[model samples]
Target: MSLVDFSSDAFIVAFFLYCFGFLFYGVAIIGRKFSNRNPDEHMHKWGRIAFITSVLGFIAHLTFFFTRWAGGGHIPTSNMYEFMTFLAMMVMLAFIVVYAIYRKPMLGFFTLPLTVIIVAFAAVFPQEVQPLIPPLQSIWLKVHVTTAALGEAFFAVGFAAGLMYLLRVVDFNSKEKSMRIQQRWVEFTLYVVVIIIAFIGSVFAFRGMGYEAHFIQETVEISSQGVESTTTDDVKYSMPPIVKPYNSQVQSMDSFLGMKEPLFETPSWMKGVDAARKLNTIVWSIINGTILYGLIRLVLRRRIGAAIHSVMDGVDPEDLDEISYRAIAIGYPIFTLGALIFAMIWAYIAWSRFWGWDPKEVWALITWLYYTAYLHLRLSRGWHGKKSAWIAVIGFVVVMFTLIGVNLVLVGLHSYAGV
Candidate 1:
C-alpha cells in the first residue's frame, strides 16, 4: 500500500481497537459482579488491562498520524479532516498522561468516548489531501497548531473531569434542576445533535451509492484575453444538499433537495452563498444525529448519561473536582503560549499583521479569557466544587467554539482549517 493508504487502514484498525478498549474499560468498572472473587481487585486489574489496550491503540494511531505527516510532506493540521483527527490524538495523549500520573481509570472512562465523537466528526469532512495553500506554507503551521491542540486536549481532560464532578455532586434528581434541564428539552436537543450526525452519515453513505445533487452554479472565469466573464458551472453536492440558496438555479432538477434552490437565502458577508449552501449539511447532521440518538434511547430505555453514571459509582467527586482545577492550571499557560503568542507570530508572517481580529483569533482570545476567569474565580474568590466545575465545563465549550465553531460559522484567514 501507499503510505497514505497504509495510514488510512492502520487508522481504521486503531479506531476500532480504541472502541474495543473503551468497552473493556466499561467491563472493568461494572462487570466485576458478574465474574470476580474480589470486586475491587478485579476492577483494578481489569482497568490496567483496559489501559494497556488503549495504549496499544494509541501507538497504532500515533503511527498512522505520523505516516500521514510523511505522506503529506507536512504535519496534518491544515484541514478539518487532519485537524480533527490530530485533535482526537492529542486528547488521547492528554488522557494517557493524566492517567499515568493519577492512574485514574475513571479519567479514561470519561475522555476516551470523546475521541469516538471526534472520529465521527472527522469523517464528516473530505479526506482528500490538497496542496498546501500560501498562508499555510510556514514552519509555524506545525508549531502553533500542534502546541495549541495539545493545550486544548489538556483542557478537554479538564472538561471530562468537570462533567464527572458535576454528575457526581449535582443532585440531578432534584426537582428544580431536573425541571431546568427538562427531559423534553434535553431529549429534543440530543435528537437534534444525533440527527445532524445521521444526516452527515447519509451524505457519505449515499455518495458511495453514486448519489449527488446535480446543480448549475454561475462562475466567473478569466478568458484567454484576460477578461473575466460569468459562466455557468455544473456542481454537485456529494452529501446531498438539503437546500440551496434562493438565488441558485438548477438546470436538471431531481428529487434530491440540492437540485433546487432553497426558498430562503442565508445572510452572510464573507462566505455568502457558500454559507447558505452549508445550511443543508448542518441541518442534515442534526436530524441524522437525532434519529441515531432515538434508536439508541429505544434500545437502552434509559438516559444514556444516567446509565453511564451508574457504572461510575466508584468515582470520587472530590478527586475529579481537584483534578479539573489542576488541569486548567497546567493548560492555560500552554494555551496562551501557543494559541496567542506563537499564533500572532505566524499571523504576522502570513497576513502581514499580527492581530487582524480574525474570528479564529478573537475566539482564541475569548477562550483564554474564559479560562483565565475560571482560574481567577477558583483561586482568588475561593470558588470550588460545583461552581468551579461549571467554569471548567464552560471554558472548554469556549475552546471548542474557537476550534470547531469558528471554522464552520465564520470565514477568515484560517480558511485552511475548514475542509
Candidate 2:
C-alpha cells in the first residue's frame, strides 16, 4: 500500500485512541467531584501520562497529514477534511506549547475535546483523492492559510483561557446558584460535543459496518394539464460511495448535475441550492459572546475563588485596569498583522485581488473594527477593568466568526475553506 493509505489507516486508529482518551479524561474530571481528585493530584504521574498520550496523538496526526501530502504531491490542506485536520492539529500543538510555558494542564481539558470535535467534523466531509486545481498552485496557499490558521488557533487558546479566567473570577453567594452555573456550562459543552460526534461518528461507524453513500441517477415523468413532460431519463444520481467534503474547485454547473438523487426521492426543486456549501463558520460568531459570558458572571453573583478574589479584593482597580490594557496592547497589533495584512497579501497572490468582499473577509474586517474600537475605548475614554476585559472578550467573538463561522456558513470566493 502507498504511504498515504498506510497513514490513513494509522490516523483512523489514532482517532479512536484519542476518543478513548477523552472519555477517560472526562470520567476523570467528573470523578474529581466524587473522589476529591485533582487533575494534578498525582502531580507527576498523571501529568506524565497526559503528556505522553497527547504527544503521541499529535505525532500520529502529523504523520497522517504528511503521508497524505507525500502521496498527493502537494500540501495536504486541499479540502475541508485536510483543512479541519490542519486547524485542529495546530490548536493541539499550540496548547502543548502554551501548557509547557504556563504549566497549566487544565487548558488541555478544554483543548483535547475540542480537537476531537474538529477532527470528528472533518470525518464527515469527503476524503476522496483529487488533483489540485490550477488556482491552488501558489506558494501563498501554504504561507497565507498556515499563518492565518495558526494565528486563529492562538486566539482560540486565548479565548479558552479567557473563559477560564472568567469562570475563576465568578462566584455565587448560594451553592444553589453555583451549581446552576456549573451545570449550565457542562450541559452546553455536552450538547455541542455530542452533536458533532454523533453526526460524524454515525457516518463512519455505519460505513465501517459496510454501509456507504450510494448514488444513483434516474429520470421521472411530470404531467401538467395533460402535457406529459418526460424528463430525458437514464441518468441516475447517487451519492458518492464515500462522502467527502464538498470541493469548491469543482465547476458548479458540472458539480450540481453530478449529485446523486435525493435519498427519499424529493422533487428536483427541493434540492437545496449549492451556493457556498456552509457559511456558519462566520455567523455564530456575532451572537454577542462577550455579553453571554459576561451575563453568566452577573448571575453567579459573587466572587469565585477565594485566592483570586482575595488577590483582587484589595488591589486598586486601576492596577487591574492596566494589566488588561497591557494584554490588549500586546494582542491587538499582532492580531491586525496576522488577520488583515498577512491575509490580504496572501489573497492578492492567490486570487489576483486584494479584497473581494467575501463573507469571511468581511467578518475579518468586522473583527478588526471591533478591536480598533476596543483600543480607542481603552486609551481615549479610559475604559478599563471589567469594561475593557469585556471588550477583549467581544473581540474574540468577532475573531471566531472570521475564523470558523465564515468558513462554515458564508459562501464566497473564499469557499476554499468550506471545502
Candidate 3:
C-alpha cells in the first residue's frame, strides 16, 4: 500500500486500540467489584494491561501521523479532520504523561473515553488530503497549529480530570439548593458530550446511506470601488436538511424519513458560508442527543451524572483536582506561546499585521484571557477543589468555542479551516 494508505490503515488500528483501551480501563475500574480476586490486585493487573494497550495505540497514532506527513507532503493538520485527529493523539500523549506521574487507573477510565470520542469526532470531517492554501503555506503553520493543539490537548486532559473530580465529589442525591444546581449543570455538561457523540453518529449514518441534498446559494457583495457583484455557489449536505441556506434555491434534495423539504429557512443574519448546514447539523445533534439521553436515563432510571458518580465512589477528588490543576498549569504557557506568540508571528508574515480583530483572533484572545483569569483565581483567590474544577471544565468550553464555534458561526481569516 502507498504510505498514505498505510497511514489510513494505521489510524484505523489506532482508533480500535484506543477503543479497546477505554474498554479495558472501564473493566479495571468497574470489574474490580465483581472479580473473585482481590480488588487492588484486579485493578492493578487490568490497569497495567490497559496502560500497555493505550501506549501501543499512541505508538500507532504516531505512526499514522508521521506516515501521513511523509505521504501528504504537509503536516496532517491543515483541516478540521487532520487537526482533530492530531489533537486526539496529543491528548493521548498528555494522558500518558499524567498517568505515569499519578499512576491512577481511574484517570484512564475518564481520559481514554475522551480520546476515543475525539478520534471518532475527527472522523466526521473529510479526510482526503488537500494542498495547503496560500496563507497556510508557511513553516509557522506547522509550528503554530501543532503547538496550539498540543496545549489544548493538555487542557482536554485537565477537563477529563476536573469532570471526574466533580463526579467524585458532587452530592448527586442531595436535596439542597446548591447541590441541586451543581447536579443540573453536571447533567447539562454530560448532555453536551452526548450531543457531540450523537452528531458523529448522525453524520456517519447518513454518510453510510449515501444521503445527499444540494442547494444553490446566492450572494451580493458591494466592493470598495462602489461596484456591486452577485455570486452563486453550490452547497451540499450529507444529512437531510432541517433548514435551507438563506436566499438559496433547492437544486435537489433526497427525501429522508418522509421529510422532503427543509422545515425552515436560515435567518438572514447568519450569512456565513454553509451557516444553514451547520445550523441543521446542530439541530440534528440536539434532537438525536436528547433521544439518546432519554434512552440512557430510562435504562438507569437515574440522572446520568448520578449513574457515573456511582463508579467514581472510591476515586479521590483531591487527586483528581490536583491533576486537573497541574495539567492546566503546564498547558497555559504552551498555549500562550502557540496561540498568541507564534500566531502573531505568522499573522505578521501572512497579513502584515500582528493583531487583527477577526472573529477567530478575538475568540482566541478571549480564550487566553479566560484561562489567565482562571490561573489568577486559582492562585490569588485560592480556588481549589470544586471551584477550581469548575473553572477547568468551563475553560475547556471556552477553548472549544475558540477552536470550533468561531469556524461554524463566524466568517473571518480562519474560515478556510472549514466546519
Candidate with maximal TM-score: 3
Which candidate wins on lDDT? Answer: 3
lDDT computed for candidate 2: 0.57
lDDT of 1: 0.77
C-alpha TM-score for every candidate: 0.87, 0.64, 0.96
Each prediction's total of clashing residue pairs, residues at least 3 apart in sequence or on different chains, is 21, 34, 0
Q: Encode model 3's per-residue lDDT on 1-419: one tens digit a residue.
A: 88999999999999999989989999999998899999889999999999999999999999999999999999999888898899999999999989989999999998998988989988887888889988899999899998988889999999999999999899998999999999999999999999989999999999999999999999888999999999998999888999999999999999988999989999998876677888899999999999999999999999999998998767878899999999998888988999999999999999999998999889888888988998999999999999999999999999988888887677899977774
Show where candidate 2 strays beyond 4 Å: 13-17, 20-41, 166-194, 201-272, 275-335, 371-400
Q: Model 2: how far is 108 from its true place, Å?
A: 0.9
lDDT rank order:
3, 1, 2
Candidate achieving higher lDDT, 1 or 3: 3
Task: Look at candidate 3 and tell me the lDDT of residue 328.
Answer: 92
**Which segments of candidate 3 are over 4 A away from where they belong?**
220-230
Tens-digit per-residue lDDT, 11-102, candidate 2:
78667656665555544443344455453464334545666677778888888888888887888777778877888787777777676765
